[model samples]
Each structure stands twice: as structure tokens, then as C-alpha cells.
Target: MPLRLVKRLARDWFLLGMLCAVVLAVLFPEFGASGGPMHADVVADVGIFAVFLLHGLGLPAAQLRAGVVTWRVHVVVQTFTFVVFPLLWWLGDAAVGRWLPSDVSLGLLYLCAVPSTISSSVAMTGAARGNVPAAIFNASLSSLLGIVLTPLIIGLFASATGQSLSMGEAVLKLATLLLLPLALGQLLRPLVGAWFARYRPYTNAFDRAMILLLVYASFCDSIASGAFSKYGAQVLGLAFLGAVLLLAIVLALTTRVARGLGFSKEDEIAVVFCGSKKTLASGVPMARLLFGANPALGLIVLPLMFYHQAQLLVCSLLAERYARRPAPPPGA
Candidate 1:
């Protein structure tokens, strides 16, 4: 393509980083696989904990203290995040399971069960001149809710499929690897929150680095275990298409619902971004804990890997479009 277009595409740095990570994983899986020299899982767990700790530190205390009293907005965003998306995916699985590999289907279902993203949702909301505070609140709330909810949703899914779930184990993993660190960070926020918030850009970059490490390590383990061997080019393409279709459906639904509910333009933007995005940062760790060396993990996370990149590109374009809109007449 043209130079400018390449640069534009490259602006989604994390997306590009993820692509590079995949290649490295495929070629040199030993470093990140189980019992590898690097102790990848332990490192990833620490990174996740630290990233969320910074998230807790950097969060705007006043906004969170005010809380999500906008029950209408919170209800809609959380419902779509935790309920509508998963329900649709479950129904889709029933209707389309015959067409998809069982592993891919389960992965898609798991993708549906995760939380809304954190930084990107808020960042995109700000770029689009949306209600940034509301986006932050909703996205953070969704992450916290996901700690409790993703496991439950997946447990129900496993139960319905007559699959076993180690719920206690999953819960413990989440608490240690995700929640406790965040709680500790929040507790210490009084002491360091200001500094973290002042250097927010740097902290956010660190968070992205941790995410890249986690994604790379997980894919490395899967590749090492031959988890990707069953997926041919055709299967990979199908997973990509499935993820795109799901993202489109959620985007369209959120847009229509926000408009129909008579939300202001700003709130609509928050709804569109927060309600439609999913967190790769949270999903990878949760999958590791849930699946625990299941060889199908590479396939299970395939849809999410595709969907995460797709959402970044799609939302960036939408944010640009929103930025270009004429401003409303001041004070009407």
C-alpha cells in the first residue's frame, strides 16, 4: 500500500506488536512454553498484577467515588457486556456449531464472556469527544464485574455442554493473579495515585507491554503444545470472519440502542465504544486458568486475537468520523 496508509495502519502499535509476537511464538516457542527457560506463566501473572495495580492507581478517584449513579447507562452497558453478547454467542453456537470446529466455537463463546476493554475504550471515547469519564467508569466497572462474572458465564456454558469446570481453581487464580493486586494498588492509591496519574502515558505504555508479553507467552505455549496444528488456513480464516461478524453485530446493536434510548451524542459515543470492546489483557490470563494446558487453547483464543485487532482498527476509524462531525451550536 501507500506510505501514509502503512503509517496509519502502524499507528495501532499494539496490533502490530501482537502480529510480531505471534511470529516469534511460532518460531521459538520453547522460551514461553511450559517448563521453558523463561518461566513465562509466572512472569505473565506478575505483569498482569502490576498492570492492574497501575490501573487502580491511575484511575480518577473522584469519578469512581461519585460512582455509577447513571443507572440507565450502566445497566445498558453492563447488560450488553455480560448478558446480550454471551447470549447471542451461545445461540450462534447452537445454530452454527456444525459449521465450526468445536474448539473455535468454544473460543468464540469465551470471547463473548469477557469484559469490556479498559484503556482503548476510554482513549477512543476521548478521541471521539465522548463522555470520557463515563467511558472510564463503565469500562473499569466491567473489568471488576468480569472477575466475578466471566467465570460464572463460562461455568454455565461448560455445564450446559457437560464439560467439567474447576470453578474454585479459576476463582483463586483470578483473585491472586488479577483482583488482589488491583486491590492493593487501590489501597495504596492515596500515597502514589497522583504520581501515577501524572505519568499516566508512561504507565499505560507499560500496561501495553505487559499485555504483549502475556499474549506472546500464551500463544507460545499453545504453539509449543501443538495446539495450532489442527487449524489450517481455512479454519483460521473462518475464525477471523466469525469474530468480525460478532463485532459488527455488537456495534450495530449498541448504536441503535443508544439512539433509541435518547442518550446525548457524548453518552452514545461512550456506549458505542465501551459496550462493544473486549479486553485481551484480561481474556488471555483467564483462559490459561480456565483451560489449564488444554491443547485446544490456541484455537480457543484465535477468535479473540482476531477480534481484538479488528476492534482497534474499526474503532479508530469510527472515532475519526466522530471527530469530524460539526460541533453542536453552543448552549443551543
Candidate 2:
């Protein structure tokens, strides 16, 4: 490869690194699996807490309040997050649940149930010159809502699919791993929120690091337990395709809905970005708490990892296209 080409490809170094990390974990399960001298499971727990703490501290109380004031846009965005996305996944479950292990379909549904992303969705909205306030509100609210809604949605799916889980235990784990630290961050936000804001770039990187670690841990455990063998390339490949289809269907639907609702161009951009994407940062940790013990956890999350990458590429291009268009003639 040409030197410039190599560097250009490396522009998305983090995504490439994430793919390589999963591959290495799949091949060397022992390094990531629990019950080792390094105690990966313990480290993962601490990392999860830190990730959400940053979430709480970094969120802006002013933006959140402003978001609530514009409840009209949020109603559509939140509806897509909690309702439209899950309904599509539920349809997928009905259509293909019997074909794969319950874990595979359940994970897809779990990803759907998780909230819209806080960072990328908001940033992309800002890039497209959309409603930044609405983006921030919907994404932040979705994360908080997912703390409870995700587990409940999973519990409902488990009941339907004959998958057994101790809901009480799962909810408790979420409260601890996901919610408590978030609450602490919010509480302490008043004390040191400015400091957290100053270190935004580092804190964002820290969030990604924690997610990568959690993903690595899941794949390690899954591979260590022979989970990949159960899900051959044929099945995993199909899941990736399904994730693409899922995003396409969502994009198409959100665009049509946004237009039909007669939303302004900016509001449509916010709706499309905030409504269509899922939060890997939230999904990965939730997967750890909800499906950590399941051997097929790795396979379950495989679709989500692919879906996350796919959305980022598609949305970036779409946002840029929107940005390039001429602005409305100063409100006509």
C-alpha cells in the first residue's frame, strides 16, 4: 500500500483498533477471560463505573433543561429511541428468533432498547447545523431512560423467548454498574463540573477505552467458553447483514416521518441523527451486566459492534451532505 493510503486508512484508527482487539480476544481468550491472575472481571467493573461517572459530570444541566422546554422535538426523538427501534427489533425476533439461539436475537433487541448515543448524535447534529439543544436533550435523556428501560425490555424479551434471568439481579447490577456512578457524577457535577468540562477530550477517550475493555472482556469470555463455535461465520455474517438492513429501514422510516411531520430542515436533521443510532457505550456495559454469564455474549454483541460502525459511517456522510446544502433563505 502507498504510504499516504496507509495513513488515510488509519484516519479511523480507533475503529480499526477495536476490530483488531476483538480479533485478538477471539484468538487468545485466555488473556481476556476471568479467573485469571490479572482479574479482568474486577477491572472491568471499576472501568464501567468510571465511564458513567464521566457521563454524569460532563452532561450540562442547562442543556438538559433547555431540551425539556422543547418537548415537541423530543417527543419524536424519544419515540424513535424507545418505541420505533424496539418495535423493529421485536419484528426481527419474531421473524428469526427460532433460527438462532435466543441470545443472538435478544442481543439485537437489547441494542435497540438501549438509548440513542450522547456524543456522536449530538456532534453530528451540530455539524449539520441542526437543533443542537434537541440533540443534547434527547441523547442525554435516552441514556438516563435506558438505565431502567433497557433491563426491563430485556426482561420482557426473555420472558417471551423462554430465556430465564433473575430480573431482580439484573436490575440491581444495572443500578450499580450503570446508574449509581452516573448519579454520583451528577451530584458532584455541581462541585467540579467545570473541571470535567475542561477535560472533555480526555474524558471522551476514557469513555471509549472503557467500552473497548468491556467488549474485549465479553468476547474473551465467550471465546473461552467455545461460544464462537456455536455461532459459525454463516450466522455471524448474516447478523451483520441484518444490522445493515435494520439501520437502512430505520433511516428510511425516520426521513419519511420527519418530512411527513412537516418539521423544519434543521429539526429533521436532529431527528434523523438522534433517532436512528444506538449507544455502544451504554450497550456494551449493559451487555456485560445482563449477559455477562452467558457463553454466547460475544456473539450477541457482534451485531451491535458492526451496527455501531455502520451507523457512524452512514451518518457522517449524510450529515455532511445536509451541511453542504444552502441554508433556507433567511426564513423566507
Candidate 3:
């Protein structure tokens, strides 16, 4: 294969490269500084707009409706993703406080505050023959709520991490960046839905491209802010371990609790995947917006970066395993 083809292949498969590029750009932002703070904010806004547009393209309305109507599945997934997960994070923080670095601790706290992974939740729910609709509703709802909840959770619990936004400012930004596009998407749903159905593959590709850009920008900001110098590999390693442990605990609890609540295999899988995963794509951007000025925000996002990859891998395996599990004995 030609070298150009190799490069293209690498780009398609390489999440780390996009992340590093953004990190580099942020590290030496002077390469072209026309936008300044206003530009940075605009990029953030546009990126969010693009995100909502992409999500709208594949909003899964039918599945969402089905999930919402199935009150049992909806309740179980939401309770785990929103309520149980946050409580577990708090407990984990207390249990592991002494071992966690201040910045890593803050990152973990922020991770706890984020909503579940939307696309992944849908995909995993499908794989496990779970309530995909419930997964969609719960996951999307989590993201919607996350806009307000993330900032509040961070401000309340992770004060020492030095990342705080006034409730009013956070709400305004979220309304403008996220909710507005969502509303527009809803209004244009017929058109967007048709486009998505006709060119599903391309729509998904475009969405990934937009996320790739945001990922690059946010990571660049981290590098530019001198975050790399402040935090070492040892600290990062600890954060990775903590993130894995946190995810594992959530996964196990959600599955167990869902089963106890009389949820089927499908609902159990949805709960585990949605409740266990955090949005690296969304969280990084939010961190930049909320803690852009705080130097520590860079450190705070490091664990999330690790957690994002780990969750994807672990859940991929678990989703498969659950899919293959034999049906429970009748009336057992």
C-alpha cells in the first residue's frame, strides 16, 4: 500500500493522534492567535452545535419512545446511571482519597458528574439484546441533565480542584450551545431524519469527524496550559487504576441491582453499559469551558481521558459476554 493510504488508515483508527494534536495546539496556542478568548469560546460553541446536530441525525426516536413507555426498564436504567453512579463515586472518593492525587481526584469527581455515553449505550444495548429504547432515553436524558449537573457536582464536591462555574453562567452556556441545537434539531427532525436514513454511514462519519475536531482542540488546550509538565506518568497511572475500579464497581452494581429489580437480561445490560461509562468527548469540552482558566483543569481531565478508553474496551467485552449468556431457567 502507498504511504498516503497508510496514513489515512492510521488517522481512521487513531484516537490518540487526534487527542495529541489538540493537546499540542493548546500547548503553543501562539501559532495563530487571532481568536483569543472569544475565538476559543466560539470554537467550543460550534463544536457543541455540531455534536447536537450529529446526535439528532441518529436520534433513535422510535427506540426512545419504546424505552420511555416501558416504565420499568426506563426507571432501572435512569436510577443506576444518575442516582446510583454518583453515590458510588462519592463513596469511592472517600475510600480512596488518600491514594488519589488532588488533580486526579478532581478528574474522577468530574467524571462522576458527567452523563452516560450516548452512542455507546445504544450500540451496547443492541448487542446485549437489551432495551435499546430505554438505553437511548436514559442515556440522552443523562446528557441533557449533565449540562447543569456536571458544573454543580464539581462546584459542590471538588472545590479544591479549582474548577467552578457559577450556576447561572453554566446554565446559559449550556442552553446556548447544547439545548438550542437540540431544539433546532427537533424542529427540523423530519428533514434530519430523512437525511440520516438515506445516508446513515456518511452521517455517522461526519459526526465522528466533528468529535475528532473537538477532541483535538481540548487536548491541545491541556498541553498548551503546561498541564503535561505538572502531572507525571505515576499520577496518571494511579488515575487509570482508580477509573477502572470505579467503572468496575458501577458495572457490577448496576447488573446486580437491575436483576434484583426484576429486569431482564437486556435491561441489565443497558443499565450496566449506560451507568458504567462516561463521555470523554463531552466531558473534555465541558472541562475546558468550566475550568478553562484553571491550570488544574488539565490535570483534572487526565483521568477522564484514561477512563474513556478503558470503559470502551471493558464494556465491549462485557456486552459480548452478556449477549452470549444462556437464558435463565424458566421461572427460576
Candidate 4:
């Protein structure tokens, strides 16, 4: 490749790493599958705990408090994440689910149901000179709410499909795996918060590494179980296209609705970024708990992985555009 092309690709190193993970899983499925010698599941569980603990410690209480007064902005962002996004997926699936593999369809719905991303949404909002505090609050609140709401949404869909989903069991596991660690971290924040602040880069790397491990393990299990053989490679293409369309729709709706609600430009930026994005950080770990050792877990998380990268690419450009706009007159 040309030098410029290599530099552009280097910027998406994480996405490239994810692709390498899938290839590894395909080639060496036994090493990372559920009963694999590597014992990936146990390692993933420990990593998940650490990731959320770091999240709790790093989140600044003052930023969350500052954003709390902007109730309307929160409402808009959360409504899109938990309500509108799912409805769109439901309608889209109703129209096309029969044509797609069941697992892929469910993956799209799950993608819609997960929480807004934390680091990227806040980073992009700040990049655009938007309401960073509100972005932080909404992103954080969305993750907390998703622990309950995502399972509930999945349960409802299971019932409608004549499949049994134990909402109680799912919620209990999530509370144990996710919420408990988070609360403990918050309790310990005063003690370790300074350490977390000083070592932010290390914590971020830890988070990314955990996610890549989860992805490898998920695909390993799926491949070992012959899950991907049921569908052709075109299924991957479909998932990517679905992610693009879902993102485009949500972005347009959020931008227009924010304007319609008479939000200032900064608030609109927060609403658009927070509402349109979903977090792989939360989604991958949640999928492991929600689906257990189901062979379809890889297919299930495929859309989320695709959407994660797509949002980063699209929002990076959108943030640049917003950043280029003229600043508003002081105090007016």
C-alpha cells in the first residue's frame, strides 16, 4: 500500500486488531474456545471486573453533577439509546428478519439496545466543542441503565419469539459481574482515584485488551461449534451494511430532533454523538453473560463490532465538521 494509505490504516489499529482476532479464531479455534487450553472465559471474567472497576474509579463525580442539571439533554440522549433505537431495529427486523439468519437479526437488535460508548462519545463531543459534561453524564448513565434495560429488551423479544429467556437470571448475573464491581470501585475511588488519573493510558489499554480477548473467545466458540458455516461470507457484508444504515438513520434523527427541541449547538452535539453510538466495551462482556455458551454468540456480536468501528469513522468526520464551524459570539 502507499504511505498515505498505511498511515490511514494505522489510525484504525484497533479495528485491524479485531479482524486479526477473527482470523485467529478461525485458524486456531481450539485454543480459545470455552473448554480451550487457554481458559479464556475465566480470564475474560477477571478482565471485565477490572475494566468496570477502572471505569468507576476514573469517572469524576463533579463532571456527572455538572451535567445533571441538563435534564432535557439527558432525556433526549437516553430516549434515543433505550427506546427509539430499539424500535427502529424492531421495525427493520420485522421487515427483513426472515431473509437474514436469526442470529444476525438478533445481533442488530442487541446492538440497538446496548449503551452509548463512554470514551468515544465524550471525546468526540469535546472535539466538537460541545457539552462534554453532559456527554460524560449521559454516557455513564446509559451504561448503568443498560445493565437492566438491555436484558429486559432481550427478554421481551425472546417471549415474542417463543423462546425462553430468564430475565431474572440474566439480571442477577449482570448485577454480580457488572454492577457489583462498579459499586465497589466507586467505594474505593477516593483511595485509588488519584492512581487511576495518573495511569489513564494504562487503564485504557487494559480495557481494549480485554475487549479483544472477549472477541477472540466468542469467535473461537462459534467457529468450533460450526456457527459460521451456516451462513456464507456475505452475512458479514450484510451486518456491515446494516450497521451503516442503522447509524445513518439515528444520526439524522438525533440531529433533527435536537434542533427541533431548541437545544443549543453544544447540547445538540452531545445528543447526536451520545445517542447515535453504542459501546463495545459493555456489549461484548454483556453478550458473554446474556447468551452463555451459545454457539451463535460470535454471530450475535458481529453487528456490534461492525457498528463500533463504523461509528468511530463516521463520527470522526462529523466532529471535524462541527469543529470547523464558527464559534458563537461571547455570552450570546
Candidate 5:
């Protein structure tokens, strides 16, 4: 109802803006340039660095410590978020490999390989009255794990996907862009803690802006690379269906698994948020690393992009619905 809230919604509607950007780019490729539209490939690389810097600010020390102590939640969330998703992606690619272009298959694979998102997971957890600390740890661990694991996963599948690169190269790139900056931020936390407290509002704004820029650059690059030509409406439709289905499946499985492990309803919700969602913020950078500067990245990130927005919208609605309901009548 407030002006600030309205603006926040617009920022989160980044996916819609991205769709519009892509359509415009496809229609008029030279819209942004005096000489010509800026190359999407170049902007993508820059976008990766931008995202990591902002990611550093949100690193959750308390949540991470709590997760390390609990251990079980960590194991369950990680097993599903990292292990299960990647495997399903590979199997899906193998099943549909022949029907889809190799690039589309590869893109889908990359989507599965990306880490869980940090901001949205925590946000949704808070909205659902779930364990915010655990959500933070689940999402943070995914990104850290991704720095090493994603390169390895991609290396194993690269030959099949026809985009082979040594794991070492990708690891080095990820370390430089993501890990090193995060480490520096951690080291500086003590000295800058007061500053962060003082300027928290501004820093938050900057972080949100970086996310928007990354989304814009990623979709813009997709347009410039002629990525849309490779897939028809049919493929896009199927990809959307696949994303929704996979999300639902993962969400249901995570809830069951968490409860089986004896977690409370709130903890189960945290696990669901952390396990079911994928991170487009981290995915784009990882895709660029694995796929090179090729236009195919547009397709590779397409499913994840759509899934990212879908998860947010659906989860937001769900969380709000849950929030509105009264707490179960005092231990009923």
C-alpha cells in the first residue's frame, strides 16, 4: 500500500522487464547504441562480477554457524538442492536430448547445475514464519558449494554438451569473481560492521540495483545473441511446464524429507524454500563460465529465469496466505 512497497514490487518484477527487453532487443537490435547495441556477451561477463559483489553483502554469519552446529538440516537441504537437482537435469536432458537442440539441452543442464538463490530463500522463509537462519545457511552454502561443484559437474557433462572446458579454468574464474570477493568482504566485516550498520539502507539499495542490472544484462544478451531463434513457442511452452513441474516435485519431496527427518513445520518450510528454488543470480555467471560467450547461454538460462520468477510469485502468494491465517489454536 505504501510508495516504497510499490517500488519494491517493480524491482521484483524484473522478469517481466526482462521479457520486454528481450522482445525489444529482438525487434530492434540497435536500440542502445550510437554505433550499435552493446554486445550481450560483454555485458554478461560484467554482470557476473556485479552480482558476486552484492552477494558478499548478504553473507550470513549467524545462520551459517547455526547450520554447522545442526548438521542434519544442512545434509538434507544440500542433498536435494545440489545432488538431486543436477541428477534430474542430466536425466531429463538425456531423455529429451534428441528432441531438442543440443544447445537447449545444454542450457537446461546448466539451469539444474546452478546454486539455490540466497535473497529470495531468506525472504520467503521470513514471510512464511519459517527458520530464517536456516534458510540463510542453506542458500549461502549452495553458492559456496557451487563455486567448486558446478565447474566439476559441468566438466563431466561438457563433452556430452559439446562445450568442453577444464574444471581448473572454470574454478579459477569462479574463485576470482565470486569467492575472492566474498572472502574480502568477510575479512573486512569487523572494520566495516559499523559502516554497514550506519549505511544499511543505502547498501541494501545498491544490492537490489545490482540484481536488476544483472537481470537486464542477462536478458539483453540473450536478445543480442539471437537465442530466441533456436527455440519456437512450443519449446518455450514445454520448458515452462518442465520448470513448474520440477519445482512442484522438488517442493513436495523436500517437505516430506524434512518431516521424515523430524523437522517442525517451520523448519520444513525453510527446507522447502531452500531446496526447491534455483538461483538465477548465480546461474548466469556460472553459465557464462561453462558455455563461454556463446549466445546459447540465453537458452541455458531461460528455464532458470522463468523458474526464478515463478517460484518467487508462487511462494510470495503462499507465504502471505500462511501469514494471514491464525496460528493453530494453542497446541491443538
Candidate 6:
């Protein structure tokens, strides 16, 4: 590859790390599998707690408050994320679910029901010189809503499929694993917020590291349980294609809808970026909590992993293109 290509690829360190994690899981499943020497389950649980705590601690409350007045942008982004995306997956599943393993189909549905990403959505909106405050507000709100909405959405899917999911139990676990820690972090943020801000880079590193660890552990459990062996490469290939197509559809739809609503150029950029993306940070841990040690956990997260990387590559390019546009005339 050219040096420029190499540099670009290197910038996607999380993507590279994820691939390495899968490779490691495939080669030595025992090391990271649930009861393996690493005690991955305990580690993952603890890490999940810390992850949410840090999120609460770092949440920009003032910015979110500032952005709240832009209810129009929030509604559009949230609708695309929680409504249109899930409806697309449901229709897609109805058309093609028979060809895919049930787990993969469910994974795609889960992907749609999750929230818009936080850091990337804001970063991309800013890179594109869009409405950054609105992006931050909408993205953060999506994640918060996802805490209640994701499981409920999954429960609805479960009902449609005749699978039993205990909503009460799921809610309790979510509170303990996700909600409580987040609240506690927010409560404690006044004391530690400055500390966390000063060490923002380290906190971000921990966040990435936890995600990779969860990926490795989830794949290890799946491999050890013979999940991949049950489904051939063709299933995975189709799922990858589905992820790409889904992203494309959402991107086009969000852009069209933004324009149709007569949003300004900057608002349009925010809508497209914030509305089209999903968060792996929230998805992986949520999957683990939802699915537990089920053998199919790995397959269930496959679509999300694929979608995460796809959004990153596609949005990065799109953001750059938007950034290159000529500045609007003053007081247009």
C-alpha cells in the first residue's frame, strides 16, 4: 500500500485492534472464553461499569442543555435512529431472514435500535463545520434514550419471534450495569470532572481498550461454543453486505430528509452524521448484558461490528468532503 494509505489505515487503530482480537479469539479461544484463565466475564463486567461511569463523568451537561433548544434537529435524528432504522431492518428481515441465521438477523435489528454514536457524531459534525452543539445534544440524548429503548425494542422483536425475554429482569440488570454507574458518575463528576478532563486521553484509551476486550471475549465464547462452525462464511459475507447497504440507505435518507425539512447547510450536516451512525461503545456492552454467555453472542454482534467500521470509513470521507466546501458568504 502507498504510504498515504498506510497512514490512513493506521489512524483506524480501533478497527485494526478489533481484527487482531478476532484473530486471537480464533487462535486461542480458551484464553478469553468465559471460564478461561483470564476470567474474562468478571473483567468485562467491571470494565462495563467503569465505562459508563466515565461516560457520566465526561458528559457535557451544559452543552447538552444549550443544544436542547434545537428540538427540531433532535426529533429528526432520534426518529431516524430509533424508528426508521429499526423499520428498515424489520422489513429487511421479513424479506431475507430465512436466508440468515436467526442470530445474525437479530443482531442487525439490535444494531438499528441502538443509539447514534457520541464522539464520532460530534467530531464529524464539527469536521464538516456543522451544528456541533446540536450534534452533541442529539447524540447524547440518543444514548440516554437507548438505555430504556433498546431493551424494549429487543423485547418487541422477541415477542414477534416468540422468544421469551424478561423485560423486568433485563431492566434491573441494565440499571445495575449501566444506569446506576452512569448516575453515580454524574453525581461524582463535580469532584472528578476536572481530573477526567485533564486526563481525557487516558480515559479515551480505556474506553477503546474495553471495547476490544469485550470483542475478544465475546468471540472467544462463541468460537468455543462452535457458533462459527455452525454457520459458514457465506452467512457472514451476507451480513457484511447487509451492514454496508444499511449504512448507505440511512445516509441517503437522512440527507434527503434534512434537505426536505429546509434545514440550513450546517444543520443538514449535523442531521446526516448524527442520524446515520451507531455506537459500538454502547452496543457491545449492551449486547453482552442482553445475551449473556449465549453461544450465539458473537454472531449477534457481527452486524454491529461491521456497521461500526463502515460508518467510520464512510463518515470520515463524507466529513472531509463537507469540510472542503467553500465557506458561505457572510450574512447569507
Off by over 4 Å in 3: 1-14, 19-39, 160-163, 326-332
lDDT for each candidate structure: 0.83, 0.83, 0.70, 0.89, 0.72, 0.89
Q: List where candidate 4 sits over 4 angstroms from the true fold.
A: 1-8, 159-163
Model 5: worst 10 consecutive residues (lDDT sum): 29-38
Model 1: runs farther than 4 Å from truth? 1-6, 159-163
- Report each candidate's C-alpha RMSD, comma-separated, in the order given: 2.1, 2.6, 4.9, 2.0, 4.1, 1.8
- Could you tell me which 10 consecutive residues in candidate 4 have the lowest summed lDDT? 156-165
Per-residue C-alpha lDDT of model 6 across residues 11-114, encoded as one tens digit per residue: 98898999999999999999999899999889989989989998899789999998988789999999999999989988888898777777778788888888
**Candidate 1 vs. true structure, TM-score:** 0.93
Query: What overall lDDT, based on C-alpha atoms, would model 5 receive against the true structure?
Result: 0.72
Q: How do all models score by TM-score?
A: 0.93, 0.93, 0.84, 0.96, 0.84, 0.96
- Residue pairs with colliding backbones in model 4 are none
Candidate 2, residues 150-214: lDDT per residue as tens digits? Answer: 77877776765667677899889989988899899989999998888888888888888888888
Worst 10 residues of 6 by lDDT: 157-166
Model 3 per-residue lDDT tens digits across residues 207-315: 6666665555555555556665576667767777878888888888877888788877777777788878788667766776676555555567767877877776777
RMSD value for candidate 2:
2.6
Error of 1 at 192 (Å): 1.0
- Model 4 reaches what TM-score against the true structure? 0.96
Candidate 1 local distance difference test against the native = 0.83
